[model samples]
Target: MSAQEEIDLEFLEVEDLLLRTVPGLAEQWRGATPDEVEQLERIAGRPLPRFYRWFLSRMGQSMGPLAYPSQDFSARRVLDCYARKIVAPNPRFLLIGYESDEMMPLHAFYDLDAPARGDATVTARYARGGDDPIDRFETFHEMLSWSSLFRFQFEQMSQKCEGTLYREDADLLSLLAPVLSSLGFTQPLTTGRYCGLYERADAVMICGGTPRENLENVRTFLLGGSNAGVLRRILGEVAKESSLEVEVNTWTPALR
Candidate 1:
């Protein structure tokens, strides 16, 4: 392990927030075990820096949503990328994850060879930009929490409600909790402030105001995805489960 303080562990919380933005992801998160950590280092031929090691244990299995599936974040993905020549072969450079891009995806890595192994610098190279640095971070935590959070995966359709869900917030939760769960809606998108965001592979839910306690205070409820059917399905469930009446122009009527 490198030179991480107790505060460095807070990156895990940032992981949760970053993941919440994923549109309906199904991955479950639990950092790697001690043995697995040892295995990873063994493959690398050295101990990974402290921050990267802890990051693996905490968010290794699901390091946010990345470019579709080109790069897999499996137990040996670091080596895999290296072997395939996707990233630099320097053993000290450990690939954390890739950032999705329209022009070209960016591959991010931690420089184990850096002097500050405890909190090494993170570097990213464009898919076809050669060895140039498209982005750089002072620490892995900054890379994971702040940088990754802003890099959103693509969504085809998104709609902000004209108003709240139009029912007691509790009724809305009681109405959709099971519905979302059945659809594999795990891994909270974010939980620090505001209502909350929860996602699965097909749908993303954003509740702007606190539900249950006060519906009126709830300012916005956002639902978005690749298709209108996903939005329709959620509304359908709300109607079926409870008599909640919700409607939106979806910017369609606004156009008219």
Candidate 2:
């Protein structure tokens, strides 16, 4: 696999914080079995990058700056339970699950077409909403770059304070939101009932925030695409003296 195909094993660092975020995960997270790790590597079709391998090995420990969430491999295990359908996004793919009192949708792995071609786009939709990274350049590398940025964001957020959905801090939101906005929502026309944002799996969805926890939908309709030029403009507006409060916006959350 190319360097970009490698999951940033460094995301393993925040497993403790991850466990803290989702307390129920504590007991289930035994380290990945040798077979499991090998299977994952095989599925990804590339050598598992040291970062994620380290993550699987030290599934319960905390490390690194970002501090990704802990996984007893619950999501992985959940997917494993559905082995026939829950295929890897890549040969070296890893699965992450988001569950709740209400049913959370199954995670999606692949986004665009063949990873080798570089032209990629990932999408995930729930009863509520989903994310779809707007594909600009058709190149696989460009798609991969977009994918990497998104995965980094998801893994990074997973490590933040427990029970917090998406970074709650305004500064971080301001920084990431505009760029994410460019990623595109799956349906351009929202019936005014959904929120949307990017995902680690390279898809976009309306499920940006957890219900009642951190449920502010970053308005992607305001941003254009993933290009730096577009990002600069959005970021510039973010820094403006005026707050971006708009009048009477209305949208519905997708029904469970």
Candidate 3:
């Protein structure tokens, strides 16, 4: 099989595993037809990488939190969104998935001059100016796999932390809100008990009081729960995004 065909088969296998292992995790979504895929190429004026085309053929329009856009928004629309300055405003990159509130969108730019082993640079555009380098991958399959794993991890986190709270100092919570939101956290919500919850997908961070108090709350959650790995991964991501210098040992026993 060609490399693209092999990757497509691998994705199908992973999807099958997720469906069987995770209850209520995989929902059926309509995929695009072969003609539609061809149409998208015509619109873009260039051939899409084989793996991405395969994704469109298999998944059609992904729903819920898959982060892939639906077919109702055509590739032409995506290109126009960038060309007309409605989104990324960069004509060189093709817009894939756009989450406006987070100011981040998935983009792919193929080096047309390069050899056609389907080489492409896929990156997340995290800012409005479209100038900064964000998370990047060498291939479309790698990007899709990473996104799928993150969605699975977030689902696990939601199941574990449902109705749970991580109370921190109110002042500290306020200080962290904007930073977290910029890193794709949902807008903070008042729990009406003098605390607020900031969430993204299944990952949540509760804020209330002092740093020490908050640290303890995080520690208790991690040590007392089976979802510590997911939470720790999230914390690492948050710390990286916020550029905060956090000691590893301060958060979880595993690091200690």
Candidate 3 per-residue lDDT over residues 17-66, each given as its tens digit: 33543345456544566666665566456777665675675555553345
lDDT of each: 0.53, 0.35, 0.45
Taking the tens digit of each residue's C-alpha lDDT, what string does model 2 give over 49-112?
3444544554513222222243223325634634755332443223422223245443423332
Q: Which stretches of candidate 2 lie over 4 Å from their true place?
A: 1-9, 24-28, 49-55, 58-106, 110-172, 175-242, 246-256
TM-score of each: 0.41, 0.33, 0.45
Supply every candidate's count of residue pairs whose N, Cα or C atoms clash at under 3 angstroms. 11, 36, 8
Cα error of candidate 1 at position 43, Å:
4.9
What tens-digit string does per-residue lDDT give for candidate 1 at 1-256?
Answer: 4444453554545545556554443265555566666766765677677666666665566544543355445445655565577655456566666554546576766556652425666666653346745335445554444333334632334532233565654445445556667766753423322234456676666554321223342334556665556666776775676565666645422332
The best-first sequence of candidates by TM-score reads 3, 1, 2
Residue 47 lDDT in model 3? 71
Q: Highest lDDT, which number? A: 1
Error of 1 at 179 (Å): 43
Worst 10 residues of 3 by lDDT: 216-225
